[model samples]
Target: MSIGERIKAKRKQSKLTQTELGKLVNVSSQVISNWERGYSDPNHDDVARLAVELDCSTEYLHGISGDKLSSKDVLVAGQEINLTTEELQLFNELKKHPVMFHDLASDPEKKVKELLKMYKMKKMFLEDDEELGDGFGDLED
Candidate 1:
């Protein structure tokens, strides 16, 4: 299907009016209409928002068969990073993994931070054989 058709389908599946979807994605209803009519396409930021709001991938929105941005290609705000398509594909694969979204969603940085903290906690607990209080465990649960 065309990107327009896919967008329409996603929007409908979300049970959102054009206006509502536009609001969520920060665009005007008429802009959404134009997109549905294939008159124009969303820019990268818009596409990113659309993918998030629709729970789909930018690649999918672009009519490419794949997942969203990869982990390595993603940089913390103020960090310099560049990502190739292949890296993005790998990132998407990681994002699609069963437990990966547990980190990808919410705060991606938080996910990494929690993982590191957990690793350290695990090492400390192992050394002392003590039960650590809830931290990353609580977030996952």
Candidate 2:
């Protein structure tokens, strides 16, 4: 499907009106209408924001790919953020944990903070263990 068609489809699927989608992306409903009508396209940053708000991938929106789940983009406090490969792997793993998945779905920021803390703790432990063979320690210093 075209980018405009994909946006409209995903918006409807999410049960959001154009106005609601606009608000999430910090745009006006008219802008969304224009997008759906193929009058204009969103910029890079807004495209990223749209992907996050629509729960899809920028690649999907751009008609570059069909795999939405492969997106490493996420929304945090209304900002579009890209996940590192390690972070994406951790996130995918977290999705398998019911409690963590619920927490992440409900409050992404908190879940992200928790994940960051866990990553730091793990890194520290690895760093302190000389037998670990500088797994992440070599990257630190």
Candidate 3:
């Protein structure tokens, strides 16, 4: 499915309106609408945010691959987030390949999408800054 379709699906599953998601991701509601309609594509920053927020990867957002990480994999990757004990237990039970978890507190689909957006945004932002330099590179010249 397209990113727009994926976003709409996740948003509905999470019970969040486009405006709500836009607020969380620091975008306008219209921006979300535009993205969902394919009227515009998200910039790298937005894509990153969306991926983390969606708990997928930029590649997944771009539809490069449809393989989603299992809940345990998501939890493992999210170790730094300091998930709750319940969350950890849930992940532990769900981490094996062909992953499945019963009674997840959060909808895995939406949770993964959101997490992916945050992860992608953070990684992309840092990479972009590094590539652009600190803007003080010529200060000594």
TM-score of each: 0.51, 0.53, 0.49
Question: Which of candidates 1 and 2 is the stronger one according to TM-score?
Answer: 2
lDDT of 3 by residue, 30-121 (tens): 99999999888888998888777766666667787685443334432323233545554544444553333334355655554454455557
lDDT of each: 0.70, 0.79, 0.67
Q: After superposition, how far is residue 21 of candidate 2 from its true place, in Å?
A: 0.4
lDDT tens digits, residue span 20-85, model 1: 999998899999999999998888999889988987767778987544333344553323234455
Expressed as tens digits, the lDDT of each residue in 1-141 for candidate 2 is: 778888999999899999999999999999999999899989999899999898897878999777564456665544445677777777666657555444355566666767756866887887778676746655544
Clashing pairs in 2: none
Scored against the true structure, residue 90 in model 1 reaches a CA lDDT of 47
Q: Backbone clash tally for model 1?
A: 1
Point to the candidate with the largest lDDT.
Answer: 2
lDDT of 1: 0.70
How high is the lDDT of residue 41 in model 1? 80
Arrange candidates by lDDT, descending.
2, 1, 3
Best-to-worst order by TM-score is 2, 1, 3
